[model samples]
Target: MATIAPSPPAALIDGFGRRISYLRLSVTDRCDLRCRYCMGEAMTFLPRSAVLTLEEMAAIADAFVARGVRRIRLTGGEPLVRRGIGELAARIGRHLATGALDELTLTTNATRLAEHAPALAAAGVRRINVSLDSLDPERFRAITRTGDLGQVLAGIAAARAVGMAVKINMVALKGVNEDEVGAMLRWCVAEGHDLTFIETMPLGVVDEDRTDRYLPLDGVRRDLIERFGLVADAHRTGGPARYLRVPGTATRVGFITPLTENFCDGCNRVRLTASGRLYMCLGHDDRVDLRAAWREGGRDALDAAIDEALALKPRAHGFRIEERDAAPAVARHMSATGG
Candidate 1:
């Protein structure tokens, strides 16, 4: 039997006394589909040589688990699209068997979930988050530029067949898919899957104006209350989505409002890039390069780099959408940081 390594004495606690328990480690920045909101139509992906090896990624996950990270989520431009992703997930999922990690989950576009669901389930992943902005086929194609709604729907079905709990993440866009929020909620309820609406964030330079598509969740919630009679739900899923449930229904609907409210007080997560750069806050540009540290002096050096990063963790990410032509707070795209 392979022996599990003992965690270090001190835990990863930020300057604001917020314990870092969750880590979103990105495997690859390369993705198949180019969503209009996420990136430009013509794009250049990071060179393969710039990305960290699967062995390095697994080792970093182990290091985080040792430093009190309870939840490890493998995020990406699309995690399932990466080669040998199942092996990487299984390597980190071993911590679940030892009780060192509480959850080993992932967020995917679901276009590739059909081929990976069985391997992921076998790797000890019980839950997954799927990014599905629209239920309509034509709208989906337009939004994603190269995605097939039928393929995504089939992937979702494949995930459900493996007894995996699925949550559909929909980005509520004004003049885009706002009219379908009500119908989307109904579909989620009928399909026995939870649905979450996320306000579009200003991440990178896209073809369209961010203001044009920014849809506030406050209006969406008011609509829900009137239509479905939503009851406030205290369902905490470790992420920043405040939940609500329709009266007498099992489905829990979530709203992630980053624009209308301050959702950073309870922030306990950090994003790690595929290149091993640890970003303490998504909206801020502060980061620590762990690849060089790990390659230099191994785990001890990597842990020290993590400690240095905790000191730089901001109290709150001051995310504000500037003027129509102004630059975003953080210049890098969401895909580069890990969606």
Candidate 2:
């Protein structure tokens, strides 16, 4: 017999007064593409039994929504790879219809979005972020290892055709695709999609040293300023990206600088892994095993675990370049953490 803790309060406020309103939920750890920066060449995915069932995910999301979560983003090794994800999206849609959830979004590699986009849009998903590094087929194949540029492009088109607001996320690596910053920006703008340039952070394990691949967005921004005369915009999409707009053009660009710039002060989100672990911070290993707690003690136990985990959310992530080189590497990969 175990003691059942009290129900979690309706308000989820951390020690730093950052009200928790956003949730990034990983549906599955399986992926179709092996992006060099995201995962290693050889990867071991969690068994289906180890991952959360759609019902379990819905229950956990409900718990969070009951607390204070308004926005939920489904992530994964690639969320589209998860079977029957449309069902989960529809389940979350019920919450959205009732005003319990403000937004239901997803981040995917867009490999399978062509098939899943219609189903996802019908299920109430209106916003999507596609991870595309290069527009060139050969370069894209090299970066993703096995991704087809044509398929990804079709997927992006499908998502837009289905009326979902599409955003392109590009992880800029020094010698890999940094040279294509201008081209990527131009292509995204031409396609009427906002593009975000992300600074490669120290997450997961890769064959090459992370420092070798690290490319900050400062140089990219300088080039954009010089080339397009881009200026900072006051618009924020409720994420980490700093938005900028090109003068006389409707195109907007964003920079997510997790290493050079830290946005933890305004951090208002927590992540739930596919294995039912709640992570307080992305850069830290602090997590609560909610699956065990839920199986053993039900909702109260899950709430208790979440309460305990929220208390440990660090003020800031220690993911600086020097610390990345010096500190012990994180054991869990980004796929496992739902990056």
Candidate 3:
């Protein structure tokens, strides 16, 4: 009898011994809102034909799952803006039910959640991350350029009504909506939603200087500690944010300090752009054109391309805004790469 050989491990481990189990997949680069920090006012959106179809997305996701990626978060300029998103969610959900994927989540601006929340929840999206910078109506409009605060609030309610776990992501910016941090926290606590404060990064072209908008969360974290008696919580959802619980309340606030405090050491995720490019790091521009491989050589060729990209994953991202004038700037925009 011939001896049988063991199969290879089904996980993508980088050079730093980190097992990458999460994938942020961008379904579309088009967005409804034009946030200043995310993109420029006059931007050219990608042609519809350039984007990967829903089937293509599922195929790429399946390949990653075969290689040990169990969790996936659909993101975009705003994922909800993409057509046939409900069907896409259902397709990914089938993978979840089959045990090929563990979780399927989405990060949206919540502009269209009111219309699609029920379908999304029924389709297997159990969790959602909504981006809301300010609760104030005028301030919200100013921040998002064309957003209605009431619409987003209603969308949030719709998402919750559908039994989806909702988390609010606020990109805290100095002189922008930073003053509303305390108010936002209180509102989230009242609504029974967890909140996360994110420091703005220099990923894409913004309306102002990147340094001007950068707001470190150190001060905000200190404020939470002193005012709300905030304490670190021993809860992690396999994401980068650090969770802190408010005493006497079930509400938890998180801080994602990509700038003031780098969490690249614990990085265990990779990104897939809507255009079929695999990004090794968000802060860096290292990418592999998987679409080319798929069209040229099919699944085997794409698997080889993915393996090559995984091997080239950088140990850490060299992100520094202060040194922007000295070093080469990141040319890719956040919209194109997906946040």
Every model's TM-score: 0.97, 0.95, 0.95
Q: What are the lDDT scores of the predictions, listed in order?
A: 0.91, 0.88, 0.87
The digit string of per-residue lDDT tens for model 1 on 240-334 reads 99999988878999999888887999999999999989999988999999999999989889989999999999988877775776677787888
TM-score of 2: 0.95
Q: Where is model 2 more than 4 Å wrong at Cα?
A: 1-8, 323-329
Candidate 1: residue 156 Cα off by (Å)? 0.5
User: Count of backbone clashes for each model?
Assistant: 0, 0, 0
Q: Quantify how close model 1 is to the true structure by its C-alpha RMSD in Å.
A: 2.8
Better candidate number, 1 or 2, judged by TM-score: 1
- The parts of candidate 1 lying over 4 Å away from their true place are 1-7
CA lDDT for candidate 2: 0.88
Candidate 1 TM-score to native: 0.97
Which model is ahead, 1 or 2, in terms of lDDT? 1
Estimate, for each residue in 78-191, the C-alpha lDDT of model 3 and write its tens digit: 999998999888887888888988899999999999999998998889889999999999999998899999999999999999998889999998889888999999998899
**Positional deviation of residue 244's Cα in model 2 after best superposition, in angstroms:** 0.4
